[model samples]
Target: MNDFLELVKSRQSDRTYDTTRAVEPEKLERILEAARLAPSACNAQPWKFVVVTDKELSNKVGKATSGLGMNKFAKDAPVHILVVEESANITSLLGGKVKNKHFPLIDLGIAAAHITLAAESEGLGSCILGWFDEKEIKSLTGIPASKRLVLVITIGYSAKAKRQKMRKEKAKVISYNKY
Candidate 1:
């Protein structure tokens, strides 16, 4: 596989993280920079990323990501990145309303993807978590009520070995010209 394809294939969701291992500052900065450079609709860039490294705060944020045994591994992650959704620019907002689309949400997703890819390139493990207690997380992070918490990314060293990735054949997922 080509270098880009290999990098994409190697990236995976890692829930089991090495609690003793901490992410390097330079690596985290690069990941954040990648996310910042992600493209947004009309370049509105309606997003904010809050990085949580404090152990106590991380535990609280992790608790918000956990319930019913889901995302239990988040509690052990050394870094948590909160992707907060902000309102888009006037043009993007009007375009979204007129076109019946939520551009900010799409922009946030793109940014999150950039974050994960950058983390993988840095040799760190990451998991994009959407299931979380928004209220609890907001209280812990002091995020404004106006901003919506879109995604929480857990970053750390992988404690578990990589498993082979499973995917449908390209023929099943892609089509040429017409559907």
Candidate 2:
């Protein structure tokens, strides 16, 4: 996947992973670097990435993500990047208030995208998980209760094959100048 569009097409939510393998430190560092370089409104960079690699702790965090028959595969993933929302800079705060938009959340979303894409480029599969026990995870990670954990990204060598993407047609989603 040298081409960017092809890379985008190939990336998917990988639910099954090869648990025996561990993500290399170099590759993980590059992925984190990509997230660090993600753009933010007013360059606030209002987020923190908690990279979880320890087997014992990862299992606990993964267990917290599983409940109500959802995200059971998270426990098998070798790496989990916990995205913690942080305070935004003054400029981003004022701009968001004036525009009636929450820029930090949006900024964090962009960072998540960067992380997943970088993981793909490193030949690793990733899944962005929004459903999890936030309180339990916070306690495990020792994160402040006040801060919000926005996303938990699982990354590892995928055990499942790539499936065709099901999406709406471009004609239905795109427009020239008018709605």
Candidate 3:
């Protein structure tokens, strides 16, 4: 695969991580660095990533996230990057009139995408978890009241070899502009 395509192709949801394996500090820093560089609306940069690598902390986060559909595999992953979205950045950028519904979460999505792809590049694995009790997460992680929890990204090294899951063929997803 070409470099870009390889980056895209390499990414997958890895839930079963080897408890013995871990992301080196330097590689983890590089991945977060990539996330830090993601583009944002008016450069609001309203996203905060709280990484949980400590087993006790992971359990706390996992306990707080247990009900979400995405949390199944997520609990096992060694670290969970809690993504918080703040409206203040965009609001401040726009000079006070808060026009939401499009800015906060969107900026967070961009950051999460960047983080995921960066992890893949480093031979690390990640899963974007979407379900969890927001209030519990905030309390568990000590996330402030002003920021909203957007996603819980589970990150760790893959315990097994890489393989493709059965998926719909690309021909079905591509379409002409008129279609």
Candidate 4:
């Protein structure tokens, strides 16, 4: 998986994980560092990664992510990285207002991509989860209610095999000049 395109092709939203294994601290730290170095608009970096590694706490946070038959596998993952949305710097805020686009959300999305990709490079599986009991998770993690919890990323050894990716034809998705 040294090639960047191959790495992108190999990365998937792994649903099942090997419960007995734990992610190495060094690997996790490197993954966080990758995320920390993710580029942001105006270098605001308006996000915080709240890592949950303790068994009981991770399980609790995972449970908060499960309901309606979604993210049931989250509870089994060994680690959860909670993506907390923070306020952007004044320049980024003004730029976002001027452009009518929320840059922090985009910045956080890039950070999440770095996190999952770094996990994949480290031979770990990761899933970015958006559906969860935000208030409950915020309370569980001691995050202020005023702040938004954007995403929860689960990381661990994958138990499932990779499936061939299905995508639209290149012609349908790619264009030469204009739409």
Deviation from native of the Cα of residue 175 in model 4, angstroms: 0.8
lDDT by residue (19-121, candidate 3, tens digit) is 7776788888998899899988777888788988888778778767776354665666778899987654645556434553566567788899998999999
Model 2: how far is 124 from its true place, Å? 0.2
| Cand. 4 Cα-lDDT | 0.96
Which residues of candidate 2, in runs, are more than 4 Å off?
A: none
Residue pairs of candidate 3 with colliding backbone atoms = none
Candidate 1 Cα misplacement greater than 4 A, ranges: none
Q: What is the C-alpha local distance difference test score of candidate 3?
A: 0.80
Instruction: Please list all clashing residue pairs in model 1, or write none if there are none.
Output: none
Stretch of 10 with least lDDT, candidate 2: 1-10
Query: For model 3, where is the 10-residue window of minimal lDDT?
Result: 91-100
What are the lDDT figures for the candidates, one per model?
0.94, 0.96, 0.80, 0.96
Alpha-carbon TM-score of each model against the true structure: 0.97, 0.98, 0.85, 0.98
Question: What's the lDDT for residue 175 in model 3?
Answer: 77
Per-structure clash totals for the candidates: 0, 0, 0, 0
Candidate 4 lDDT, tens digit per residue, 34-136? Answer: 9999999999999999999999999999999999999999999999999998999999999999999999999999999999999999999999999999999
- The alpha-carbon deviation from the true structure for residue 64 of candidate 2, after best TM-score superposition, in angstroms, is 0.7
Residue 166 lDDT in model 1?
A: 100
> RMSD, model 3, all Cα superposed?
2.9
